[model samples]
Target chain A: MRATFMYGAGDVRVEEVPDPTIVQPTDALVRITLACVCGSDLHPYHSMPTGEEGTPMGHEFIGLVEELGSEVTGLKVGDLVISPFAFSDNTCEFCREGFHTACKHGGWYGAGGVGGAQAEMIRVPQASGTLVPIPGDVDEKLLPSLLALSDVYLTGYHAAHMGNVGPGKTVTVIGDGAVGLSAVLASKQMGADKIILMGRHVDRTGLGRRFGATDVVAERGDEGIAKVLELTGGEGSHVVLEAVGHMPAYEQAYGVVRPGGVISRVGVPQYEDAPVGFGSLFGKNVTLNGGPAPVRAYIEAAIPQVLSGEIDPGRVFDSETTLDDVAEAYRLMDSRTALKVLVRP
Target chain B: MRATFMYGAGDVRVEEVPDPTIVQPTDALVRITLACVCGSDLHPYHSMPTGEEGTPMGHEFIGLVEELGSEVTGLKVGDLVISPFAFSDNTCEFCREGFHTACKHGGWYGAGGVGGAQAEMIRVPQASGTLVPIPGDVDEKLLPSLLALSDVYLTGYHAAHMGNVGPGKTVTVIGDGAVGLSAVLASKQMGADKIILMGRHVDRTGLGRRFGATDVVAERGDEGIAKVLELTGGEGSHVVLEAVGHMPAYEQAYGVVRPGGVISRVGVPQYEDAPVGFGSLFGKNVTLNGGPAPVRAYIEAAIPQVLSGEIDPGRVFDSETTLDDVAEAYRLMDSRTALKVLVRP
Candidate 1:
């Protein structure tokens, strides 16, 4: 099977790899139909050290079941299904609470001897609890949005959900990537009264506004903070969605958040230490939350929106590629030439 | 009039000062009947530099409205009132959201030319919005509980409220101070099923247990974390109420919090930065929140409970001092000889 692999920083490759098998009774083999490059991939792309056999890449994907282990239930061969970025048994205490990302018996794809989703066939452990089979015949038009439910779209939803974004809220979304744009959409769906999208890219911010951003601020750092605050009537935003994991984005979150507001960082933090004392979060009485999306939790509710055409989350995919050209997909996302690059295997 | 002032580290004095009077239309003169030395006072007590006049030394107090400003409605002269640690107009967005600490026109009593509550009389700004009047003649026995609502008790309630403590949840409180014990009491009131009080002092932890702690762990650092994890069946507490502002207290919070849990820090954080990366809060998807208690918000809901004898939060005060003996109150708290010191002016 052909798969994506990273040998080191600035090195992404599509190479032939052995097909995955159902090694555990609760596992099943999945043939990925759709996958994508993520902004998080850029983190490793910028500095991952060279390693033996390289590393499997990609965690988001929609697929068809190719083979099922004897103990696997609620799934059959050839069934179209969606797999969350992280696989969980769905019954663990954490998973039961909708925090599947931190499930006691769950793990992410592409690590710990598991193959990444950007592959021809991948073995899925805890298959019964991990796979959400699409009902009836799947519509081709909903593919992108359904695929999005596996990660990106839900990641954005997680940011808004954790930030307590809802009616009468003034939200500020930092970053113009697919996840950030998705947050703008989610905030709209959640009935936020106003949303300020912050980005330097005019093209992406335009899409952000189209997706429900009431305002756009093409500024960075101090100016961006000032603009957001000014737009929010000098009190700053009720909820600040930090979709860019960089320190600057985090800083902007704190800077533009109203006292008693929330800062939800869905972007994986590239740095560890942050100010939480009087000079930052504590004095303002702000809440800092959001993490790995718990993508599994949002998938069920999002599927109907995609299937019914209530939302078009797949709009984030600005470019497409095949497994054979997966490297180009990474390149497009890395160079910011594409918002998100879809991979069809 | 006499007032308490801190000239420098380890120095406190009760000296003559001009009587307080309303300077603004929103100001009212309050005659201090009850005040207390708070744990936070220790922060400045240990490091505040010597100055010509010195800093006024208290915020919490139950008092009588000696004189009302022309604009101060909802309050009358001779009305018994409770003042939150911070004063706010209670009309700004932040105050409307119950975050009086961050009110746009609000300020603390001991700062900005305002005399502290540890005085014969103190001028309160935003009187109509700052003072919560007792409905009737206050019973002498309920005095302590009413005073507790001014800062300590509500501070604990803020931690529990922000942490989302509720039925069927496990809580871990990391401090044995008045605020921490108040947290234990508050957690129980919120219906937490398992309350783990983590403190080394037997006397204080004993009080915590009496308040509501179902379990007590005296271990500190890794040992404390291990004990808490063991008590939670290895998943850690659902809510970790951090009432000690030091880094170690913060570390213990993360160490003993279950994935997707909340760490509420009412403790005045002494450090400027902390680990917020995958190794700490982010990876586990833990929510970090809490700040100076919006004592004004909870006073209303808590008043009935105190009046009805449902809770006796005032039990936290272990020593008594008069205006002339205020310096000894500071010394007792500084040496940890008193859990909290009550002051009668």
Candidate 2:
């Protein structure tokens, strides 16, 4: 089967790899229908290898269950489902608390030598908990948005929830990519009174505004925070969503939140030693909460909105290509030419 | 008026200073009935000018309102009150949200050019917010413990509250000073089932046990955390109270809290930067909250316990001396000769 593999940094290729089969009794073999590049993928794409071996890329996907292991329950062959970026048993104490990402037995696909979503068929561990049957028949046209619920949209929503974004909250979103844009939408859904989207592009900024960004700051670094502070009456936003993982964006998120506010970083930190400055964070009495989003937790509610056409997150897919063009898709994403690239398998 | 002043690292003296008078419309002159040495006072007492102007000391006190400014309301002369360490207006939005320490016009006492509380008469700012009226007269002998609620006890309670210490939760307290001991008491009040007091003193540890610490670990640093983790089946405590303000204690707080748990630090970090390695905090999704305690918020509920003898934090004051013996008191506390020293002016 043709699958995406990283030969090296900036060297993602669609190569002939063996098709995945259900090896564990609790696993399900899923045939990928749609997959999109995640912001987290860019980490390995630019930096040194994250794993000991060459890795498969991509974790966000919507797919059909091609086969199910004997131990798998609540799922059947030929069913369309959404798999959370991280696999969990969904029955653990942590998962019971809606923190599936922190499940005792939870693990990540496309990471730790496991094959990822950018494949013809992938074996999903703990399938009963990993796969959420799609609400209804999902058209290929809406696959990108549904695929988004598997990771980015839910992550944005999780960031909003963690930051306590709600009515009358003034939120500053630091990052204009799909996750950041999704946060704008989620903040609106959660009734944030004002949202300042910080970005460097006009097209994405416009999309951010359309998705409920009450204001946009095109400046970078301190200037962006200055604009956010200005918009929030100099006290800074009540909640700041850090959707871009880096020192600068993280620092900006810290700078723009009001005292006793929150800075929720959904952007996966690329470095092992991410310095979440406690001194600055402590002085402001701010709360920092972030990790892999509990995508399944939000999917049950988010999928309905996407299915009802209430939200059109698919508009984020500015480029679309076939599995054969997966290499160029990776290049386009690496070169920042695409907001999001959808790949059809 | 007589005031306790630190002449140098080891030199304390009772000396006459300018009598405090109401400087702001919101200020009141309080005749301090009781004042206690705080752990924070040790910081400057150990580092102040060797032979320069001696630093005035003390920030925690219970006093009788001897004079009121023209604008003061809700408090009157002759009323006994508990003065929170922080002077805040208490009517701001932040105060309404129960974070009076972050009130818009809030100011801390004793460290930033503010005169010390170890004086016969001290000026109280934002009197309406900073001073809580004592419900009824209590025995003068109990003043020491009641005075503790003005700072340390309230601070420990705040730490426990911020860390979400509650029923069935396991809590690890990182410091066994007055505040840490007080936290053991507070955690019990909050319904925490398993409380571990990590201290090195037999006397303080005994007091901690009486105050509801179910376990005690005398080990320090990494060894202390290892003991805590071992006791908790390697998952670490559900809530960690960092009551010692130092790099090592802060690191221990981070090292011992379980994933998705909380670490509350009420100990004032004297360093310009709170040296925290966020790699662990971020990965575990720990909620860190601490600062100056908002005692005004808790005094109303805590006074009854103090008066009824249900909780005697005053027992922490192992020694009492005349203001003339200020030097001896400083030395005793600095050398850990006393858990707390109460001085009579």
lDDT of 2 at A136: 67
C-alpha lDDT (0 to 100) for residue B235 of candidate 1: 94
iRMSD of prediction 1:
0.6
Q: Which stretches of candidate 2 lie over 4 Å from their true place?
A: A49-53, A271-279, B49-51, B111-113, B270-278
- Residue A236's lDDT within candidate 2 is 84
Clashing pairs in 2: none
True contacts kept of 1: 0.84
Which TM-score does chain B of candidate 2 obtain? 0.94
Worst 10 residues of 1 chain B by lDDT: B48-57
Clashing pairs for model 1 are none
DockQ of each: 0.89, 0.42
C-alpha lDDT of residue B65 in model 1: 90
lDDT of 1 at B63: 90
CA lDDT, every model vs. true structure: 0.92, 0.83
Write model 2 residue lDDT over B282-344, tens digit each, in one string.
666666667667777788889898999888878889998777776777788889999889878
